[model samples]
Target: MSIHLFQISLTQLQGVGPQKAEELHALGISTVGDLIEYYPFRYEDYRVREMHEIKDGERITIQGTIASLPTMQRFGGKTRLICRVTVESMLVTAVWFNRAFLKEQLTPGREITLTGKWEQRRRQMTVADSEFPDKGGAKTGTLQPVYSVGGSLTQASIRKMINQALIQFGALIPEILPAELLEKHALLPRRSAITRIHRPENTLEGQEARRRMVYEELFLFQLKLQAYRATHMKQADGLVHPVNNEEIRQFVSRLPFELTGSQKQVINEILHDMKQPYVMNRLLQGDVGSGKTVVAAVGLYATVKAGHQGALMVPTEILAEQHTRSLGAMFEPYGIQVGLLTGSLTERKRRDLIASLQMGLLDIVVGTHALIQEDVYFRSLGLVITDEQHRFGVNQRSILRRKGMNPDVLTMTATPIPRTLAITVFGDMDVSTLRERPKGRKPIKTYSVKHNMMDRVLGFIRKEAEQGRQTFFICPLIEESEKLDVQNAIDLHMQLTHALPELAIGLLHGRMNAAEKEATMATYAAGETNVLVSTTVIEVGVDVPNATLMIVMDADRFGLSQLHQLRGRVGRGEHQSFCILIADPKSENGQERMKAMTDTDDGFEISRRDLEIRGPGEFFGTKQSGMPEFRLANLVNDFEVLEQARDDAAALTASESFWSSQSYKELRDNLNRDAKQQTEPLD
Candidate 1:
């Protein structure tokens, strides 16, 4: 009759049969600990309304009586009920479609309270999701928790299960934070917080509980990051590539374009890190097309010149191939050999390449995750760089790092996170940013348009194609999805082909295999495909300089950084590139994203706006190497708490007793587990 804490499965709980357990498991709540962590995404305040306060477009509660029986009729195979409810003195029409069953509840002189949205234009109110209470039964104000449900799950069911858990195991949940720390921050105890989160008595209590949960989440995250840094710093000496080598200087001098000051400054920082004895674990952050690849190439060349090998791991095969082709061309005159390893290589050719790498015949190598295969080996690898590293998982980077003995690690990201967010997210690594685009790269012209201007946009793309340029149409989905109402790549491609039959259009998405994607991209890059229709899968490693127009459908569905990346795909080419957003977003946040994209082409500014609107958990999602969904914390509102947690972690970790204390054994174990569970991407 005892609960085993985090290990106890949800199936063991009362009334939780196999079907119920499966539903919970789908939501990542297989165990008691996960259930405790599955906080509600939102809460509804059930405020009882005064009848006089009814207004158009407002959600209000009305205490009323059914003036007469509602009229039920069938219209086009659907039943509808119409009634006039008397609220105090005003009688307003209430309608329900396909709910003739509710006609029984609208008996004459029946008294009730109804809550729903009032639409003035429709001249009626709907009761689809409204809550009702018996009239004169003394309605009570309350708050209800609404969870993210799917499949067979429902919000009411989840709330019921959580309340059951609170009754059974709430008090037994252990507290990990020190008493002094809790008192200093005015945080509620762990047990009290969990109970209040599930079943709070009032609004104020719920806020206090949520605040405590946010603080704990932030504190644990910072504590683990500090531990990871401490662990990494204790590693053995790393290989050094002496800075200011003649080969490096000569390579930079030979490039076609001059390096911007920001690029130069970042190169200095990276070179300085490489020359140091300790492992150079640095993050290179730049906006899309800010010359990050060139800097990475220079670092790789420096390591090769020092008589060591270099490896660049990218996320996709197309990107890997592009880097290999470009870097091979750039390094050929310098006598440094560049190699490629990918899933698409034939067996014999791949084996020969592996042998050459093992024998140190190749000076530099570019590859997808294939480089992390067991057979791949490097001869004295000194530097490891991951391109668009956000596309990679933390373990993938660590595995590549293990290929070389304490190699200097440099991770690059094109997402321009604010400096403050960067500190909290990548606190374990030194950060260098490239804030400038290379000279001669024209700023992209962005325009936001509604769906009504579709024909005009199509004509614009046709015009660009007539000039021997290309265009990209980005959709949010690879195929039609039941849940998502946005356009899909397949549907868009078909529609575009019908609209412009003369132009050669191509289709690309993430679901396409390595060979298929490569072929599709090849045709597009060769200008044979005048218009390429794709999903956001083309977000990374797609370079078509001749492609001048990027039209994103459902543009509001994408984050600002993501939209910027898609916009970047077009502006890479000269000829006054343009990005057209086809959108009419329904939500305020979506409208904000659309406005931000049209306001400026600056990635950093867009990123700041993205973080503010979407929050950090989503800002760093799966496509961009996000951490776990934070249940409580706001990266913007709680930035001060983040700073405090970071300071506390650093100060506590520096203390001798921090690791040795017996009281922190559970906490230490949790930190290690969290570090392994989350992917740490460079911002």
Candidate 2:
């Protein structure tokens, strides 16, 4: 398939000169195909309105006679147009800011239709764009698409280009889906969907078109992910390690506490996967204090008992060191040699560990990214375990796998993601959940307060510290600036140290050097520091069993999932813990978010509710995280369509006879073309 289509040539569009084309290209609209595929983020319903039924901030279309001729006046040397209109005995004022030439478009006593939001001020009604309306009564009651464009590109320009593209190629769109699959799924043909999306005759048709497109995109994406997983599984050569029940039983018996049923279930699942001939690609998802680490440790011990080496890769050096210490204590009693390798270690120490690893003298190795370095070769790496797997990309995981003879992977995450999102994001991996906390862990009491209650919050913190319990004061920013964020780490550190002069205070953030950060965390972990003021860098792996309090300043600035993870830092010990959320936003969503935190402690429930309230993109930090950026589909809002698409794809792929069909070939070619286009350089 060629990159260029008959309608994709922007040079052929009316008013899209080379200069304008370049501007459009910056918005990811280099061709007509791009314009057509750039689906609307939302629709504005302006199809029906009455003069007497006008509400404030309601987008409406109304036709009326001009009560007076539009007049232009100069305000601060900028021209403005002011006019009045009457609709069904209702009078409204219209203002066009800095649009002097618009007055000519509206003549006195001329009947015209206007589409804009109604505003009520001082018992008067006003419309922003009342002076200019399209010719055909503004096509009332239809869904109007809103495109995401750059500041330089106006919505009108996008609408125009899309309309032109549809007119040029709407009838020529080749159907790519298999006919039987489309029929079974009740999906619209490609041509009809594209046409209706660009130029719908009614709201129903527009909705149908959008549903079809969103489903198709989601289905194809899931299919690609599943195919990748299947291909990898078929080609991977894995070592089959039988379960060592005695080793696991010994480790469990030595522990002071008993494992929950959920923990035991997860351990059993891992053992089952290890006994399989194919490699294991699994994710262990659990909430804070769920004892997932111990489960992973048991899995590591089983692999080592089978005479194979395992590597635990963590995102941060602090986490790696913590894991090394915990695992070393457990394995040492059994005569298992465990080595620690991190970037912060001395050159000589790192070299020694690497030599021991290569010589098969080490049974288990734990480190950060240093473990994946080419110089650190494993004797017989069979299992690769990554803590907080979301922190690393797919390529990084692949690099670690290449180090061993196709090692079985077990990635763990404490972030309790919703089921729908987890399936969509990690559809390729087998999933196991540890829903139960340890036997003796206490539930953390949570509270949401306003900024005015700072004195009370500080008093509570002082009381906890006086009891010899550690506390964490988390901030969203590193330094105080002109923004509305709470006090920065430096400012908060100073204020807290001054307030609690008798207590030890420390600071930690991403800006600190590795040594400085490790030292600060070590002091706090060692119980030498009573209070630690820091940022979100501590959200992941700074575990202190003595810490019993978490104070999140300006909680509105952080996402619900992130706040949940931050709250997880505490409540790890037997002592009663508390997560204090201080947020003061006047918006309804802000208030609702604060209330939601106080209402529930379950991370997965919070994640689902957050998706419902703020959408999936915001819940996962999609813009920054660089997950699949869909132009047409919303993962949260269109989940039903996504599922339908997945079913449709599965049905189509299940029939072996369809692979040789013409429709199948066309679909494959179209998918390949779309994949190529999606991956191309932006310019």
Tens digits of per-residue lDDT, candidate 2, 488-555, equal 88899999988889989999998888889889988999999999999998888668999999999988
Q: What is the C-alpha lDDT of each candidate?
A: 0.82, 0.79
Query: Between which residue pairs do clashes occur in model 1?
Result: none
**1-683, model 1: which lDDT tens digit per residue?**
11355678787778788899888888777777778778986776566677556578886666677888789889799987888888777787887789877887788787766666787666467765443465333224666787888897888788888878777777668887867679999999888988888777788999999988888888887787777777766355887677666667788999988999999899888898888878988889999889888999989988987888999998888888899988998888878899889988999999999999999998898999999999999888899998887778777788999998899999998888776577677878888999998887899999988889999999998899889999999999988899988899999999999999999999999888889998999999988999999988788757888888999998878778889999989777557999999887565777898889889999989998888887777778745554545667777778788888888887777777789988777677677655423646342
Per-candidate clashes come to: 0, 2
TM-score of 2: 0.84
Q: Which of the numbered candidates is closest to the native, going by highest TM-score?
A: 2
Residue 225 accuracy (lDDT) in model 1: 74
lDDT of 1: 0.82
lDDT for 678 (candidate 1): 60
